[model samples]
Target chain A: MGSGSGVSCAVTLNTSLTPEQRALYQDVGQINHLLDSARTIALVGLSSDRQKASFFVAGYLKDEGYRIVPVNPKADIILGEKVYPDVASIPFPVDIVDIFRPAQEIDGIVDQAIARKEKGIDSPAIWMQLRLVNLAAAERSLAAGLTTIVDKCVKMEHGRYRGGLHFAGMNTEIISARKRKR
Target chain B: MTHRPGPRKFGFETRMVHAGHVPDAHTGSRAVPIHLTTSYVFDSPEYAAQLFELKQYGNIYTRISNPTTAVLEERLASLEGATGALVVSSGMAAQFVALMTLLSPGDEVVASSHLYGGTVTQLKQTLLKLSIKVTLVDPHNDAAWEQAITKKTRALYGETIGNPRGSVLDLEKLSRLANVHKIPLIVDNTFATPYLCRPIEWGATIVLHSATKFIGGHGSAIAGVILDSGNFDFSRFPAIAAPSPSYHNLRFFDTFGHYGFLMKARAETVRDVGACVSPMNSFLILQGLETLSLRMDRHVGNAQQIARYLEQHEQVAWVSYAGLPSHADHALAQKYLPKGPGAVFSFGLKGEGAEVREDGKKFIESLQLFSHLANVGDVRSLVIHPASTTHQQLTEEELAACGVGPEMIRLSIGLENVEDLLWDLDQAFHALSRSIRA
Candidate 1:
């Protein structure tokens, strides 16, 4: 297990350590494994305004091969995907639920995810958009035996982990070469 | 010390902080004061007549010009190495004024295929509705522009560093192409402010900025500025040079001499459209411009660093930044934007397969530090997933044409410490790793 300084997994461990924890651990593990296997994303908060961070990051992630799912109340559909008001409303089983809403609204979203989890719908993970504060809810989901990640940007992570950082438009091949060795 | 030239010849930094501004003439105030008044009273009827009839040039009305805004225009012009500039309400207005001044009904404009969504809509939809024809060309291909030109084409338009994709245009080639055809080359330098790349220096006759982005730095103000190089010989383009009914048979070239284009744009297009920059916004933009050179350096540095970090990550699929040597336009970027390609870049992620629970979208949803908003150019870092957001209106084929794919992610690096940014990224990937393990 990685060090849990910024995030605490204890709250999760205390609530569900039975077969469910192992099952969830396995489930999240498989989801990440599948992400390694596939390439496409559907971001919900993708906006068109350049002033909006969602606009650029979504574009970045799309450039990375993740089929983006832009979900916004104002936009009918984005990146060719029919944007839904909520995850449960989506017709398809998405691998991830990237939330770009405010921190306060995350609890209800987590509740929706929980409802879906109860209905035998197995989502791989619940990824919150950056700065989407919901530490308690993230812990609750983790306790429920689901994989939870927070406080990070999906685009930056993919770039750093997938060896895409070599394309910084400068001579940084040596750094990436070293990183690959790790 | 006695023999050394003062801050005038120091460097870009010193000039940005001090150029075109001195203590207030009346109060001896060292700082540029925000002159909020709407109109400057004339001393007498003769003075007002002189100001109105162009016998002299001074503040007549805030609608026409303001002292605070003048400082900003002068500073921007100096930075861009241009002879004159006009500050406007927003970058969009600046573009509108530029177009309105140069193009009449039935005239044509040759523009790049890869442009801001708003700009594309304006040219294809709004401008078309106005009876102005627009020819779209893939800026990547030099020949496409050559083939699109017509006798009615008045100007060639493009962005210095294309938005979203970060594709760098070869300004020298486009400028040469325009020159050969006797048309003006207008560039939107919003992405790459003069601090990074000055289009005017690269043969662009006119340059426009959103100023709302890095220029404002804080994302608090919406404003724009147009800089005229005053290098183009308008006489060669008789239509623009020979003005008539719009301004009382006054031939711009014959009267205004060097600052003809800028003067005409302000006097006519902006006057009618009423897209003048508000004094408050102008003051905000001026404050932002003072630190532009400094902020831009850090923005580029951090972006380069973060882009490199993301490109090497195991979960990433592809990366696109002109600063990246492997990028298709790296050579062009080197030639045009040698001072470091603008801060924004794009990348993609490896999505999960059916057996895995979280898909690529899930991975994005999992991140924590990055803010998922619709705006960019803030002091803080920003991120977005494009296929589903900014370009949602476009179809798959359209997205592909714009170089956007399913897993693509765009990142606009901020001025934060690079290490902290990387650490935040590292945690997100670790979560991804953990999720995959289950």
Candidate 2:
């Protein structure tokens, strides 16, 4: 699962000593690298709610230099970006199609991604937020030469990679350990 | 406390009432009295050794097991169609022990993306720290599950019906995938009590219940149970079968035979981690389980009636309950839960109009009968504005990923008279109308 680049190779070795560990590290590392490289992410279901993870994570990623496109039917604008009703109507090349819909609706999203590719839009990477993976669609994206990251949180990943621990405002290590102790 | 004739074998409901209890043998009291005592007296060193060495299954300490709690465990195990059960302090503890026994650091768990918010947090945040990676996939799409599994994958997890949104999972497909991969399928059957849908019959290897919900039939208890079907072959999972530095070189599969996973979880995970359910809570949950079948029947009926009522309401924008034919997963629900979809659901208000606040918080505040709270699985209807509450911690993008909108109100339907419930909703809607007009 390691990328051809030496950076992933080094991180893979340093973090994961076992073969299984190496695969997981490499898979997540490659996805993060892709996220870092991509300039624009079209977030399907990006809400206008300030308290939402989508709102905060998009805000954070926008600060990190990626353009955030809010694709919600309800909002006129989110994070200063005009909200598009769907991916098909976004009217721009989308580098990544980050979905916030349920797993059951992912097949439709994959179809939209493929349609975008057919229309000469760059076959964007497909990233499902935590607890939001569509395996069939993920495979279709993979077959179409698009990258896929599923069942992982974009906010948590940003925190993991950008050295921003405690993004959720709770100390993970101490809290979980104390929880285990109790 | 010597094994004691295995608590008078009886039918499931009867045992639920009386098992692990014997009229307080000393006190001659009929009820299964709560033994709040933390420590127990040892008959002798030889007897203690026999208990520790698995020579006998008796109460050595409260942390391991208790008489009052054992009845709940036995009853739940019987009801869930499993050989044995472990009652933990909380639903999270049950999940933690189940995963810890099945997975080691660096192993993987393939789970549905549709899960409770706490579980999603646990898998993505807490479990990630332990180096046990989780792969989220659409459990409805069997291929996605198959693709997510690598050699390192250990288990598959899903809720019978998703929390908040009430999307039904394709348990049969997930179970088949787990079998093909030689991994156990663990179904969190909290939303659908055993009376509604039993995952064991559908190929789930283990079942977990947040007894705080329907199992308790009341909101008083916060406990969880893990039921081992004793179906999945642990010999297939070498990591679990092999000796560990954690325990005194005791291979769980070799020592516990069919109940290896449950035994290891009790001895290693529960003993070391110490998340034992209180005897009092166990007693409370047992009382609830007695009326589980009856309560769930009413819960399903009330939820169906309310979902229909909400669907027809003028003020509601969208209703996402599987019982509603318009729900995207309605067909899947028909397949997995033919009887009826469980009680929880989500609906969005008409927040786009100029009269309504763009955030949709007003509609939630307008609800009268629905208590606004962070918890779910209550006998009384519950409501929350996700953008403001349950998922407030999530980013805007994350909230969308979870299908939660600022204007969305998640409702956990309770077992109230449908007519009265609707009257309350009518008044709430009328209030919203007044507020909008004003």
Candidate 3:
């Protein structure tokens, strides 16, 4: 984000976003359902770096009692889990194929997750991360009976499901009873 | 580190005014109060013990932390997008504290040759006595940095904009080199300030300022601040990661997480060195910070006009402002400091040899508006001729290497109307030309 210039993309922020795009961006039910039930997740495009958003999210989820399988051909390991080259190469069944790729790259990742389900693998849920949206890919997965989530981070959903998502100054209580009565 | 939003989330101007402060809680005071007191009251002995032991966070001594200084620290830390900050008495002291915390005997630092004269002395002379070796390299020459590094090389140091002359730094290249060498990049951001550039955004692990300068904006107080990016992994650097014999064998990195270096500097160095700022100075600097964007805007705007005026003047040989298209670092300036090349810049006189040095002195003496001074970043214009003043003893050849010619004059442009400043220079040049002909 600080690479090209130290300023935000103020103009590119879509104030006139289409209705469907806005709804897809704000869809918390599908995200909550996918996050609440998924025990094991395959993190697509996971970086080895601990500072990157993808790696930090994966680490947080892992600490929250979720098993994570990092999928990246660039490395052999991430967060101590053996990284698979592709989702189809995961030796065990994955309940969720969580994506951390950009918008254009989402179709290619969804194609892999859809192929896994057709070959007698567990009909996995598809989760696309923040700023990643493909309405066409999401529709195809929905038509194939695979639960689909777009433009939402799976870890943030789990955090919200447990109560609130805290980024910047925005807080959603992600915990139920962490606070005590005096 | 306390869940503050990134500077990217707020516009630069918005962050300037509201980054590290909020309205007063009890009195609902809109102004940041000057917290004047020597010590903070603790609720109980247990609370005092916890604060002392670093088990809990609260202020005990004004020397280590104060409410007024905390606002300034947070304001600057937010502006620079740093995880934490430690405000000190002066820019030199900030440099001393950061280096002291990071270096032990036998450690080494690879620094840029283009630095303030005082910094050159700090590295080349005083710091060597502590057994830390510093090898100065030309920052523009990447290979010189590589050649200077040894197994003991602990860090790399440079300024956001080089001193005396405003030579912009190639932040991307320098940062990549530091990362590859497994070292942190420390940047002295006194000249640029966060208003013009945030060094942390360009991978500077530590960013510091002579808050006495532009951060104070009025030359009202002497202060400095050290900002930690909290991005560097200290676990690989043994100085910070290793267990401390004085602190119950506790390792700072293991205990403080991302803020280990600053925690160590605050707990050990600031506590020991005792160069912390007074609450009164902190309040004054905060007032300076609140208007930094407005002041810097005019400062840059006025500097641009004066630099162009001097460039075309008959008596001027060369101008060294990064904003000028003719400068050697023009492209680097556009990349790193797009908000304008800042207020302070230098230019050289036209004559050669002994006559050149004489005209430089005459020009300075003839200026009616610009005050001859030892400082920069003042509300009023300032002029200094190094050949006749600061570097008077150095020969022409020696002065050239340090970005100064015997005929060079440095200017710190102020917020006054441009016409007045240009008129003052014109009359000075008239006096200079008459003396030259006679």
Candidate 4:
């Protein structure tokens, strides 16, 4: 029988992510920091349908006090906010540009975010929704000194860190035997 | 270890100790700290609104969710391989919330006849007040269970190991039956904790535990937990699938998907009814959960010895422990509870009618080391005459239905040395024999 002190491995226990992958994706402390400091989020591909994941996430982020800048070409307005056609078209600065678009469209989005960063229109960090990842696009974003997070849900990370995910009992991937103190 | 890309699964013991919590991020403390506040501070009015609307996850009031209790919920969910878990004030509260959440007026439930006495009353009597009907059927009889279901039947309920009766549920057979009928199977796993069986793995959509029992093995706290497997498609269940007027016509199933049932159970039922668990009780249960596997091992070992001893004893009529090969459910127990059929079991005292009742009481009163009490699953050995104590509320017919006869004496074998427990039982039986002669 093994001791209950927890596994000695240096990787996260909940998921089978490798050490390097864990540092990249499962460093929830970093995600928590990002969620804490970032304010406005430009939600690319925010859908008008209430059933869509993007719409739910956008609405959730808006409720969490983050200003949601909807970036969808199909709609003039979504979630009660005026929608931008693209990242470059958005006039005001956004702290994070969360993508809900397909993986094939990520390279173009990253290029636009880089152009906006150079022009000082927006130096927004890039976040891809769960199951939408583009390694090449992430590399380009990182090269432009933009923090690039892939395949993670921004609303989920916010809920996980703020102590809300337990309300419905979703595994937050945080493994520890000790409790948190206020 | 080979590198993997998805979430790494921890062993059961590892999960029991660390699955739900991380160290105090601010204080660097390695132990679970009790957050005793009645509520939490929100970032703003908007944030509070988000919490109330269920758009965001965070604490608002202790009556709804507490950080300390959340840890317990998470740890138990992890151990049970469930998608999520909710903790309530007591074992009965867990059963009530789960049933009330799923069943509406006119809906029906088919449950095991072999169950804790209070549960039978709650199902047969109290739920009738809501117009929700329940049919009691033999747990091992699949055909009876099938015949009991009708168009009104929404959920099938049974214990993994029947309380006091010690009959093991055929989880797979019932789950299959539930699936064929497009209903959910809810199981009470108080007797077989995750260490022995995970009902969810066998297709139970919802699993319940009286944490007041083995999960809080030391009997230091009273609590209950309900876990959702997140495997059931509730798109047809009206309570979950249909829009609710209570929350602006929000459809829990359409919105939360896999987590719909639990989210409704917490946000709607638990929020309104207010049978929430105390953070102190949750903390005490967490302490018990840490050593659960180790304690269960010794508990089973002691129980197995006692069951065998009682089976051959001159004063003992029959032992109903599934761990004993003579038990009617012994084969089923081996399939579901290979480790052992838990620490609690019942044995009948030798005699008939009034004489047997006297023997049962005398035997309990004469026990020197074992504490005679109504509760079970404690570190210290406990004994109870269910006909006179726990099951006293039931009529003679109901008593026989749940297998609690007047001669039945229940023993919750604990973590004491086997020889000492055997000695305690021997002395008690000897004292009972002398009293009968006198």
Candidate 5:
């Protein structure tokens, strides 16, 4: 309901932010670039039910031309993709690891992402879901030279990037600051 | 615009005005606009489908969510420190939805015997028709409460300041029992409001309100809200925690997490029952909430003075106001409602038999300031002969048990000058005496 809050209020907590790191996440254009370049997204803790936010966001990302890799112990498959138990279990390289888990679970997921990178897997950027934050996880990911995003949704970021949210009457903080690139 | 975020961490008074609200980006309206449309237009077919599927949180139909009502819901939840809330058609509807959300046909509810008569009827009769058994225990008896629960019990329910009786709930003892049993403790704080007491702070899992009362201070609207503390695990509750066939095996707790109960109540219960509050009533309730603290303060002050005045009067036999030192519940009220014992109270007239009823009616009719009606918590003073009006259907034993005596006259103290209220009652007692002589 806020101008800049967009679809998610995206309150970044737990993960300590330096002035520079805070600026990076707040910069809408930089976020837009990240979404544009991503090819595949791994949604950890994704559920099979359509009502779940993770399931919805994964479907949206797949529709937007990004391959969705479902990662959850409960599901055998989701969004027509084979489900993996964790980040390290994914058969192919994941460009982005978007976490849909709670704040408490983010640290473990981040740790797995770090391990995957250390074991010569692709260094996928980490994106934490809305309202979920872990400062230690963000710090560890950033220390390993990975692009870390916290307390934001990948679907909403893409929606804002394409100027597709205004038609839905969502608070598109996009048009004003970006000078109507659409 | 580049300031530190999370202004939401502000104080209650500030949040009451600003929470769940923002200037409309399109219209720049500072006030939350009442979205009168019954349905919202989706950006795409996929978007509409997603909303219907509960894949995302967005307004699809007014019955499920409206921007205006959503703001009121958020503001109330914020004021009560609840994780989420749902606003419905009336105070009764709010109670129904919240209870119905947790209850199934075979489940049970353990409730306090001292409660609003309508609520008593709701639990005893209506819930029975649904096959949901309710066990009522004397609120003062700790052992009775302990014995009422069975494996089938789904929730524990009571009122903060009971109707007619004005007895204060033992929140600590009640919370302890609820915790031991692992069932959610629910309190209807319609009388106390959050200004006086927050049931959540005392470990209540759910706090409900008949927004028609103090929440809407003015008698212009009928509304109710159910606020969840998000503390209940709901892990064992199949309706909330397990897969549902209604929405493709979707579990509300798995999806919404912390505010799972509220989300399920709004989406499933409200959608099926069709008891959502209109955007118009939602707007009016929000208006009342803005000055709630101010109105409640005056209401409490007037009530304390009026209760004391009636206590010393020769015509008055006894008063049932928790704020009074003579009240049986005064100690409990002091602990839970230290701000004051609220505005509504009952007092018995002197003399006995059928003549007491006549005198009670005459006293209420003779009053110029107090409006004689069934409603309470009005900005203007209201009077009711509960044994004859609100409790008319109840037998003598039932009425007496609820503290509605034959000589009882209920008064809802308002914001009128205390002198005028007392003077009005003073003259009414004279009228009762004059009628007796006639």
Candidate 6:
């Protein structure tokens, strides 16, 4: 198995998780694969306010050499990237659609993602930000053969595997005894 | 054949080697690079403002964080099972920064009487200058510890294995006391080095290490680290939960959650104190950490043999190593430090007052292999007379309280061959006897 981020995906799961939950939310290997494979990410609900988590994560992703498309109806540009009102409106191919909207709003956004795929646009993976889980919509996206992530922070995952989150005293949960491979 | 999922938790040995670093993305260098630069470039004016305002996490200057030092912090944190760690200039700086961040002028601390001489001075003398009073108590007296906790008391402090005398602390009991009193239990785990024991696993909220010791394995680097378990609820603790005018009313606990204390220590305390560890020292310490377990196993094995040999000698009055069955804290040692209570300990010589002190000096000088030095945790064995050197600043009563006596000769066992070390000790004992006869 290839871990493009150089972080081991082996993880102990909480006993409370079901088989479906294990394959979906807890597959760190898949998360690593997506992070490594995706080059262009479209961040839905990207805010113009600097203090917002969405804005902070978008800026971090942009800095890490990822092409970020800001999808906000209110903004023209964010973090020096052009803003599109929705995922479908973006002219270029998008590998991931990261949603920072509320839990209730995930279905509408997933609908837009599905419509884009049906129209022969790129089959973009759906990512719901931290604490924004929509299992029903996630199931629909999964049925349409699109990778889906829920209730996770994209920036934190990126930082966790790439050896960045520990700087602020956060636990990265990576335990290996060998020096990181070259 | 059924597919089996690999074990989720990596072993300690594996983590020691690999936990804190990844290959350099640009150059593919497997080893940790010494980032010798003082400052990092900002992408834009707006980005610079965000970093300065603590709205984002990125390198601003080496004083706060360096790529090399960050690996040391993360690696140590991984070993200790702590949420995060901060590296400082020296062991004293780690303790000072931790206390300064956790306390105000009127706050108080309850610490163990059994501690390194330098730590005792920092607690009793220096902290007093800041109006923070520290009351030393018998670590064995559970009642004394609880009685010392007043409303003004902010932390309970102790060492995992006490210096010189080798008294093992009852971390679980003290942690429970701290929990009831709503204070944090801060432990100096310099002696145990997370290989033998992790104070955080028992209940400590914070752990401090003089990485100058076993963490470095070799005596090449002088550095320290402070680790936070992130288990303490700082919601009511004003030092962390309250807003700070220094950073335009930023509340650490509210802003960073579990990472609040260390982030404040690094951004505010270390930034102002300028007590930052250099990237070169970090690289050296990292090299030492790679072979920490290997060195410690030999150190412990050699120490057990030496302590046993010393106990049976006719000129030796008593041995204070917790690994010995006759030791007072031997049971506690088994509980806290199952891999033996470290290699450094103290022993008394057979004689009365003035004669015994003379014998100690003679014995240390006669040893061919053991170097006479003040520092411990070196790869080479070291000997010191505590009453005349390390603990000489303390008065008689203070010296008695700390279990240091005129006849006390402290030994920091090294990774030398046990047979060679025993032969050296045998010759030193004979030399002392011959001197007394003359």
Each predicted complex: what DockQ?
Answer: 0.01, 0.01, 0.04, 0.29, 0.16, 0.25
lDDT of 6 by residue, B1-438 (tens): 997864267778877987777555457667888899899998888778868877667789999998899889988988898878999999999999999999999999999999999999999999999999999999999989988989999999999999879999999999999999999999999998999999998999999999999999788899999999887888899998888778777777755556779889999999988899998999999999989888889889999999999999988999999999999999999999998899999899988799788889899889999999888999999999999999888778778888999889999999888899999999998898899889
C-alpha lDDT of candidate 1 relative to the true structure = 0.70
Scoring only the A-chain of each prediction against the true A-chain gives TM-scores of 0.68, 0.76, 0.77, 0.86, 0.83, 0.88
In model 4, the clashing pairs are A14-B8, A15-B7, A15-B8, A16-B6, A16-B7, A16-B8, A164-B57, A164-B58, A176-B21
In the range B89-140, model 4's lDDT, one tens digit per residue, is 9999999999989989999999999999899899999999999999999787
- The C-alpha RMSD of each candidate to the native structure, in angstroms, is 32.8, 26.3, 10.7, 5.4, 5.7, 4.6
- Candidate 4 residues lying further than 4 Å off, grouped into runs, are A1-56, A63-67, A71-75, A84-154, A161-163, A177-182, B1-7
Lowest summed lDDT window (length 10), candidate 5 chain A: A173-182
The native-contact fractions of the candidates, in order shown, are 0.00, 0.00, 0.01, 0.48, 0.07, 0.29
Clashes of each: 104, 16, 6, 9, 1, 7
Off by over 4 Å in 1: A1-182, B1-10, B351-364, B394-398, B431-438
Q: Candidate 2 regions off by >4 Å?
A: A1-182, B1-28, B352-359, B395-398
In model 5, which runs have C-alpha deviations exceeding 4 angstroms? A1-41, A47-53, A60-96, A100-109, A115-182, B1-8
Write candidate 3's Cα lDDT for A1-182 as tens digits.
01111222111111133646544434444455566578999999898864355765677677666899999989998978899998878978888888887778878877877888888778888877655677788878877788877665565456433421211111221111112111
Q: Tens digits of per-residue lDDT for model 4 on A1-81?
A: 011233232323223334675577545545666787899999998889765657778889887678999998889989789
lDDT of 2 by residue, A76-182 (tens): 98878888888888788888888888889888887898888987977787887655656677778778777776655565455434423221111111101011110
The segments of candidate 3 whose C-alpha lies over 4 angstroms from its true place after superposition are A1-182, B1-8, B387-400
Q: Please give me the DockQ of candidate 1 compared with the native complex.
A: 0.01
lDDT of 2 by residue, B52-130 (tens): 7433345777788786776677567656667568899999888988898787888999888777777878887899999
How do the residues A1-182 of candidate 6 rate in per-residue lDDT, one tens digit apiece?
12233445454321233556656765677788888899999999998876456776787888777999999999897888889998778887899999988878889999988988998888999998755778889889989988998766788778776666755545576764334333
Error of 4 at B239 (Å): 0.6
Q: Write the per-residue lDDT of candidate 1 for residues A29-55, one digit (tens) a residue.
A: 343354555454546566655324465
TM-score of each: 0.67, 0.67, 0.71, 0.84, 0.83, 0.84
- In angstroms, give how far residue A110 of model 6 lies from its true place: 11
